[model samples]
Target: MDKKGYNTKGRGGGNVNEGGDGDKWSRWWWGLSHRKSAPSEESSNSNQVQRSPSQSKSPKQKIRISSRSDKLPFYYQNWFLVLLTLMSLSCFAFALFVFLYLYPDSIESSPSSTSPASSEVVEITYGTVLKLMHEKTKFRLHSHEVPYGSGSGQQSVTGFPDVEDSNSYWIIRPQPGTSAKQGDPIKSGTIIKLQHMRTRRWLHSHWFSSPISGNQEVSCFGGDSESDTGDLWRLLIEGSGNIWRKDQRIRLQHADTGVYLHSHNKKYSRIAGGQQEVCGVQDKRAENIWLAAEGVYLPVNGSE
Candidate 1:
């Protein structure tokens, strides 16, 4: 159509028909209309007039909205789904209960085996060992040694004995410190008088002494046949195998006298069989040492 002869269907027709422009436009926008030209489709359908391209539109583009998807299923989107669902409610209630009841404690206490608050300690003594069920717990000797003491006077010392014949045995508990777990080794030479920190409470200071009386024949580990010259603070607990006196080493032997700790004065330490120096002295009996030191000095039947 010629620019001037193109049809104008509505009122207000102009002498010039820009709609019939000589320049080519691939398609007419739904809204573009020359003031002197026919109405746009938007004008015809204003009810659906949402987006319309323009002859001179601003840089900003318009948006068009489509429809929604299928609504959520009843089970999934039901407003009261949790309120009436027994299983879901139970789970929810249980979750809420766990969260409310256990979460705080978990955060605060963090129940663990190593926590300081996880364990408690109690003080005890060698006697405490007697209370333990022997069938359930095994006795481990962390350490043992003769009471360190002096004197050849160990006899009938009943004033302090806890048993009828303490020198012969021990009936008290094994002082335990850092109780050994099952299978742990029992240190043979461990000095029971001194307790490790973990077992400090169970170590009774009384274990440091023995109950011996005067009148018992005491021989110094390195003295002559005359008198014993053993350290005033040395005692022996057990020994065997051709034992001899070392200046420092002593032995407890079951001789004609009894279970006695052979001892000598500090000066006569480590004597031998030769009568010239004669120092292989045996205490002969527990009642031979007077003031015992740092040992559960058995009277004569106090312990094993």
Candidate 2:
């Protein structure tokens, strides 16, 4: 047992020594062993430091992965652009529909939309002076001056303005209202009769043959002062003259007969002198075109 204890003490490098020289050798050996163990511990710490970064980097990589997943998908990324494009298209469609629906009539009535030959027509009013002219010879419509005492007399249209005949001016009186008092508005579709401003006679035509033009019927000024079918005439605006622009032509059609008021190249006798006798014909001619303008104001009565 004593020898075993001696060996254990010797392992400490002369731990059995009791003198100064022995203690010195023991301390030196112990110092050498401690120094060798310290280097190994330092190597282990350096390894731990290097492994720490790799261990912590796993969570950091996970954080980066999660952050990337949090972003919206590529398909949904441009949601704002998609919504804006849809809204813009919808607004444009709505505006286009509104424009087309609101102005349909305007588009149809536009001059560019209508046929080249067709034109817009308008209305003609009362108190219009119509100058009946020959298609070949332009002449003013005239009536014969009544004798000193005559109820009604023969009438003819003349182009000669040599004498300013008041008979040339005829007042359009709508038969619906009072002869000279309550007058109705004269329009393209209105049924009217003309009265001689001076003779105070309404233009009347019968089945009688014209003395001058044996082929056509004669038109004379004679009818009831109130109203008569023979006196009623239908007024129409020529081709495109219904718009009532200045110098528009008018047409007079006999109500009793389908003939139009026409003057020929023939010369006829009249109270005013030699004038063109107005006749009624079935065919339309250039002479049938008549100009209308505001004429003398003939009062319905003394107070009117």
Candidate 3:
């Protein structure tokens, strides 16, 4: 109603709300200057670095482990293997050293190149004096001047308590000597017949029970022929078949029966005038001990 389309103040529409218009134009110029003065935010963001999801958080650094062998160069890998081998060899050497140090005595005492000769058994030869001393009473084997046998063949064998008695001396010889002479030591395993020096008969045993010994094996004088193995005697010295050591005990094995010569107890009241009864036994006992001596055969003049 009051000139609705036309403004008449200086310029076009300059009269209508000049204060508001002036304010609006000032705000617009200020915004435009601010934008021109500062750099664009989008352009700044593009220039700055931007991390991807995979590369964030320090890129997840890989863990690393190193050992002494790993520090070596690629060319020295074989040398690392050689070093391990050397260490294994050193362990073996140390083990061997411990073994020798712990068992020194065992190594020395073992049956080696060197040993004492005294430990070995000595072989006995023929013609050596053999003294068989009794292990208990020190008695000896002896023969008396008694006579027994049929018509022309008779002999005597006796046991004595006193070794000093002349009849107590017996010689080990291959054959009986007719004259009085010292007998030589017979070799071991020599099958021989023991002859009584007084009666010149071999020591013999038979199936007949001993009259004086009460049903024991009868020990009598053997004839000159010695046809049977019963008259044969063998001296065993500690299983070696050789002369034993001094005071060493022995066993006299009979060739016929393989029994050992044994002595009975003195309690046998009738021991034929206090004479010790000698019999055959399997094992060696105190009574079997006899002090053997090297003596001459003093043959009785009328014994033959």
Candidate 4:
């Protein structure tokens, strides 16, 4: 009975020892699994931290690209506005230049035919500015500062073809020792003096032979204060009107020489080319007829 009990106890003790060893092996396996799991979790956390920064920077880069694209339209729009402004200014300047070039008469204030003061028929009075036109030759009596090459050697006179020449303008004046005033009416047989408007000279004639016709030399001589009997001219009215009218045909007879102002088809060559010669003739021919043309005539008794 005792041997049987000992065997039973020994078997029981062996069973307890096997149970302790199994417990220790199970604990070791559990610890090894826990350490491996810890390493895997740490690697996963590190990977998440690195990916989070890239993800955060991606949105900022997208925002930067979107901002650049949004500004492009505004930049082009600003340049377009500048170009439009420059084009508009250039067009305005061109238009202003064209306007000034087309209308030059708006600034000119000379005595033209379209002037307001020369639109009506007015009487020829003393101090009246006028142009004398030859009836037969259709030339204007003109004079300049040029001296005659031959004959009287005074201020040369000619018949100008152009009606717009300012040199043809003459101011009618009374004789130096006459009672006639500025606005007085001129009679048919009145003795008058023609004063050049430009040079202030007087129409004069002398006994010297003419250069072309060899009859007499008619020229412009003297000034506002210097005058002689050679500057005098007698008006011979052809029609019946006692008062000299603008439409009346008349003849001028020199007071010094018994000659009339004449012009022919003969033109000058060198000094006054293409201009008709103005001279004096003893005969009262048809070439000596003259009529008053474009002028600033004074009103008769202020009734223009």
Top model by TM-score, which number?
4
Clash count (model 1, backbone only):
45
Candidate 3: 10-residue stretch with minimal lDDT:
122-131
Task: Name the candidate, 1 or 4, with the larger TM-score value.
Answer: 4
User: What is the C-alpha local distance difference test score of each model?
Assistant: 0.28, 0.60, 0.51, 0.85
Q: Write the per-residue lDDT of candidate 1 for residues 1-304, one digit (tens) a residue.
A: 4579855543456443565443325234422445324455546666345334452243333222211123455655665765577778788889988897866654543323112221322222232221111111111112112222444322111111121211222222222344633222123232222222222211121111331322233221221222121212222423442211111122223223333332222221222111111112233443233211122211222222
- Measured by lDDT, the strongest candidate is 4
Better lDDT candidate (1, 4): 4
lDDT of 4: 0.85
Clashing pairs in 2: 134-287, 135-286, 135-287, 140-159, 142-157
lDDT of 4 by residue, 1-304 (tens): 2455533233345544567768878999999999999989988998889889999999999999999878787547599888888899999999988877986654563345522243444567898888999999889899999999987689999999987788999999998777888888889889999999999999999988777777688899999889999999999889778788887899999987878989998888888898888888989899999998877777565554
RMSD of candidate 3 to the truth, in angstroms, is 19.3
TM-score of 4: 0.62
Better of 2 and 3 by TM-score: 2
lDDT of 2: 0.60
* Model 4 bad stretches (over 4 Å): 1-121, 302-304
Model 2's C-alpha root-mean-square deviation from the true structure amounts to: 17.5
- Over the stretch 1-304, how does candidate 2's per-residue lDDT look in tens digits? 2655535355546455468557778899899999999999998998899989999999999999998877868548788988899999999999989999998776665433322222423223355443343445655676655331222224543454432345666666666554433323344645777776666677776565555665455444654445467788887776663333324567778888877777766775445355665667788877676764324322222333
- The number of residue pairs in model 3 that clash at the backbone is 2
Q: Against the hidden reference, what TM-scores do the models get?
A: 0.15, 0.47, 0.43, 0.62
Alpha carbon lDDT at 236, candidate 4: 89
Instruction: Point out the higher-scoring one by TM-score: 1 or 2.
Output: 2
